[model samples]
Target: MRTNQSSQEEVEKTLQSITGIERASPNPFFLTRVEARLAARRSAPGVTTPWAFRPVWVAASLGLALMLNVSAVMYAREALTQDDQEQETVSLSAEWGFDATVMDW
Candidate 1:
């Protein structure tokens, strides 16, 4: 019972100490200045955001990337087809028993 009473008194003292405390507030012109800066930024030109959000630049970049990818794909396909043709020719020559060493000018 005595311990409980002491704890209650301590809690009361803590609450009393906090009761007279004042609330913190920002500077009076702080919000005004922040709003003004935001407005100025919005009105300013040539502010580039992230690449994905820019209108003209994003479209152009995507178009260029697409063209490069298509070109790469076409080149790779051509290379693969040429390699396949060479392999087929070698296989056909081997099957037909054509000896390169026996060929004389």
Candidate 2:
């Protein structure tokens, strides 16, 4: 009876060892596709960018920014000057060909 019990345990162990051995992996060929894509990318020609590191673009952007800043500053100064001149009487002389008679105090 003891020998019979040992044989039964050996049979159970052997069956457990081979469980799921026939199961196929999902998408077993995925690595091959990835490697092929990588190889193609490596062998392909390098692309040239027509506008990368362009000096003209850099210069133009800088010039536009500077012009905008100067314009804004000039406008702000002009507005402040107009506000400050409200209490004064501006007189236009005949040398400039204009009338000079106005008092807005």
Candidate 3:
């Protein structure tokens, strides 16, 4: 019974050794690295745009389209004389075997 009581006291002392431990501290640069990562993610680009959809590109495209339309209208208006147009229509009709006055609709 004497030896058992001594062993019990030794076990109690060993268990009480854990109460003297201090609070744990993290690494000094760990929080700084985590904050820097969060800041980088916030500043990074989430959506990217193409260059063709920009205002200057759209304006240039529209101007080019207008220029083509104006040129085509001018060419069609000025290139054909009345006599030449009639002759061309006659020639085209003869080539295609279509009569100006036909029986069937």
Candidate 4:
């Protein structure tokens, strides 16, 4: 029982010694430097150039993409239409065994 009591007291003393907290502090001028850096960033130009990020440039790029897509679709549709017409002419010629060039002969 005496040994247990001594051990308990030792544990309590160890706990008490570890319970004291130290205040934390930043280095001097840390906040001032942080603020200065933030101000410099705010005043500095962005990482990307102004022309690349501008709304006008974005709109123009989108417009160009849209125009390209529209033109491609129109061209594809026209090509498909021409293909269908050619196929129809070929089928009609095959069924009738008549060629327009035969009239020229």
- Each model's lDDT: 0.89, 0.78, 0.86, 0.90
| TM-score ranking, best first | 4, 1, 2, 3
Candidate 1 residue lDDT tens string, 32-83: 9999999999998677677777799888989999999999999999999999
Give the per-residue lDDT of model 3 (tens digit) for 1-23.
Answer: 99999999999998899789899
Arranged by lDDT with the best first, the candidates are 4, 1, 3, 2
Model 3, runs deviating above 4 Å: 1-46, 81-105
- On a 0 to 1 TM-score scale, where does candidate 1 land against the true structure? 0.46
TM-score, one value per model = 0.46, 0.37, 0.36, 0.52
Number of the top TM-score candidate:
4
On lDDT, who's better, 1 or 2?
A: 1
Candidate 1: clashing pairs of residues: none
> Which of 1 and 4 is the better model by TM-score?
4
Q: Enumerate clash totals for all models, in the order shown.
A: 0, 0, 0, 0
How well is each residue in 8-37 modelled by candidate 2, as lDDT tens digits?
999999999999589877698899999999
RMSD of 2: 11.1
